[model samples]
Target chain A: MTKLLEANNLGKRFGQQTAVSDINIHLSRGEVLGFLGPNGAGKSTTMKMLSGNLAPTNGQILINGVDLLEQPKQAKAHIGYLPETPPLYRELTVREFLVFCGRLNLLAGKPLRIAVDRVIERCGLGDVQHRLIGQLSKGFQQRVGIAQAIVHHPAVVILDEPTSGLDPIQIRDIRHLIREVANEHSVILSTHILPEVQMLCDRVQIIAHGQLLFSDSIDALSKQMHASSLQVQLANAPSVSELSAIAGVVSVQTIADSTFRLHYQPDNDPTERLVSLAVANGWQLRQLVAEQHSLEDVFMKIVQREENSKDA
Target chain B: MLNLARNELYRLFLSPLAWVILALSQALLAYLFLSHLDYFMQIQSQIAAIPGAPGVTEMIVAPLLGNAAIVLLLISPLITMRLLAEERRNESLPLLTSAPLTAAGVVMGKFLGSFAFLLILLFMVLLMPLSLLLGSHIDLMQLASGALGLLLLIASFMAIGLFLSSLTRQPAIAAVATFSLLFFLWIVDWAGQSGHDDAGWLGWLSLLKHFEPMLQGELYTADVAYYLIVTLTFLLFAIRKLDNERLTG
Candidate 1:
């Protein structure tokens, strides 16, 4: 698959303070890359550079192999950006706004109409398509924002905090819409909501203090943090020393009086040996499930580690 | 660019601000037109005996167009203050900047859109002068030249207003700043009267100093060039402002 967007050594500085530094990103068609960062972590700055809304202080952006700085208009044709606030006209109806956005993106005639129609339907804006944007609910307004972003069928869609300020139901619906949009376009969705990233992103990039902390698929990220770890609950358990003495058990941490977290080597099938240990010792295994680290845990650990390194 | 211009025009017409400005301007101009016509009629016989006395074009049409220009000075700010300022306030400027449009195209498109609305007001005001054709003979060429002068004057004022709008996100600030700048330029020539030849540059740069000769039916290429220069200079400033916005946003 061809890469639809690429950033090399991207950096931005305001006065003397750096907003983002040496950022590199690549996205292919049919991929959704969740850009995760804490507040003030330069997520929006990076998104702005990719969308051509702000010029980078240093570095380069390529949209579909076209240099964004050298050929901005040609490169921007492949991009659609939905900023944090949605960039809506409160006085215009949803349909009118979409047509204006479509025309702005260089769509015309029947194709423009078809594109508007398809995006309206795709974003679930049919019910309020004719309503004025200010009259729509926040959920519908967010849909309109997404609708305008994708109306021209742009190859890359950059959404900054697309689900911000929405209710839970609205968030779920917007996430669903994002998934639908990603089927056809490369998407860069920036949010601090890790669960949203886990639910939607094919790959994830975590940024912290203007630096990249983690970049990989969600599964790969999980494996890196929780390799061969299991959470077990027993009716009658042995001492921690006895549990650590198991053939495959490398370490054991007490989670409760009878529950423990076991860590072992990746090549070792620790579950079988742990079950046998529990059976031999009459420690009835009530639960012995392999544990996958939550994204929040990994993210916090990465951020904490970065902070410690800086402090040292 | 044309698409943005078209959308700008649509939005301009949709807002009540444009319609209110149009109505109030027409009412004020009509009052001035009829008052001047009546005053001229009251003195017509007295002036008819005097050789080389002024007629309807000089007494009625010229001052009426002159008043129209002042009214335009007041309202063009109202029309143009929202052109780009509203987009910035609404945070919708990114929608344009992130599109496949050049910064120059966005600036030119906004200028054309605001100028188009001013033209509508100019045409309606011109109708007041053309109504003179119903009664007595009027110097049609003089009237046409004055009308062209007024168009250039307003176009240049709008360019200034567009530049001011580009500077601020507050439409009110844009409107007030535009009026302040235009008013300053309108009266800058007064300072020239007390100074020597070294200060003559003030009078040369004053808006009305260039506009007055055109009001008297004198159409010099220099006067037209003056208006064009002012319009193009401010338009370039507005375009640069947008370019800086994209760079620094």
Candidate 2:
């Protein structure tokens, strides 16, 4: 896959404070890269630099092989950016604002009209297309914001917290819309929602304190922090000491009088041994289920580890 | 740049503030036009007896053009205050900066947008003087000269307002700053004539000094050049400020 965007050694400093430092990132066509970070972790700064809204103090940005600093107009033609605040004008109607945005992106005549129409339809903004943007609800305003970003159909789309302030259904709709956007354009979305990454992103980058702590596929992140475990509930359970004596059980955590969590190595299958032992001891087994590590667990672990190293 | 300009013009006309300013300005100009016409009629017989006495053009039209200039000076700041400042306040500037637009293009588009609106106001006021063409001998040549000078003056004023707007995110601050700077330049000639034996460069810098000659239907290249240079300087300042914002953001 060809890289649609690339950044090397990106850094930004404001007076005495460094907003971003030694950051590198890349995106390819038809891919969704989730930028995950906590509030004030420099996610917006990084997105701003990547989208050409702010020039990096150090390093280079290349969009579709065009150098951004050297030929900003040409390079920026291939990028669509949606800032955190949605960047809307209160007076203009939804269609009018989209038309203005389309023109700014250098589209004119029939192409401009077609582009505006496409976004309005794709973002599901047909009902309020003639209403003033100020009069629309927050959810509709967010749709307008997304519509403007993709009107030009650039090679890359950079969105900052695209689903930040929406209801659950609106967020789901935006997530679906983002997936549709990713079908034709590479997307770099900055968000802290863990499930958003798991459900929509093909790859993920986690940043903390102006630095990247982890970058990999979602499955790889799960594997990096994976812990194999089993949840077992029996009518009558063995003591911790007796369970530890089981051949494949490494450790056991008691949840209640009849339920326990058993941790074991990947090389061993503890369920078979545990089932046989339970039958021999006349323990009526109620439930036995295997569990995999979730994205939240991995995110917390990675962020906590970074925080610990910084403290040290 | 034309596309951006068209968008700005569309939005400006849609704004209630722009319409309110337009209606109020025309009402004041019409009242002044009628009052001057009445005064000119009273002095008609006195002027016929004297040699090369002042005509209606001198007594009525000249002062009216001068009033138009003052009106533009006062309202140009309000017209241009929201050009770039409101965009920043609304956080919509990124849409332009991140597009395939140079800083110069964005500034030029905004400057021209507000400049075009001021021209509309100028044309509407010109209609009052144009109505007098049927009743008496109107000095078309002198009227043209005054019109030219007012156009140049408004261009310069809009440039200053646009430049000030680029310096801050608050439209109110930009309006106040622009008014203060233009007002100071309007009165700077008094300081030179009051105390100094020679009215030097300070007098030259006075906006009225250059504008007064043109108002009398005297077209000097130096006066024209002064307006052009001031317009270019402020426009360049606005473009430079926008460029620096992209760099430092």
Fnat by candidate, in order:
0.80, 0.85
| Tens digits of per-residue lDDT for model 2, B67-125 | 98898889988988899999999999998998999999999999888888888898998
Q: lDDT at B63 for candidate 2?
A: 94
Model 2 bad stretches (over 4 Å):
A225-300, A303-312
Per-model TM against the reference: 0.89, 0.90
Docking class of 2: medium
Q: Report backbone clashes per prediction.
A: 0, 0
Error of 2 at A157 (Å): 1.0
Q: Which candidate is the best by DockQ?
A: 2
Best by TM-score: 2
Q: Give the range of the ten consecutive residues with the poorest summed lDDT in model 2 chain B.
A: B193-202
Candidate models: Cα lDDT each: 0.90, 0.90
lDDT of 1 at A38: 84
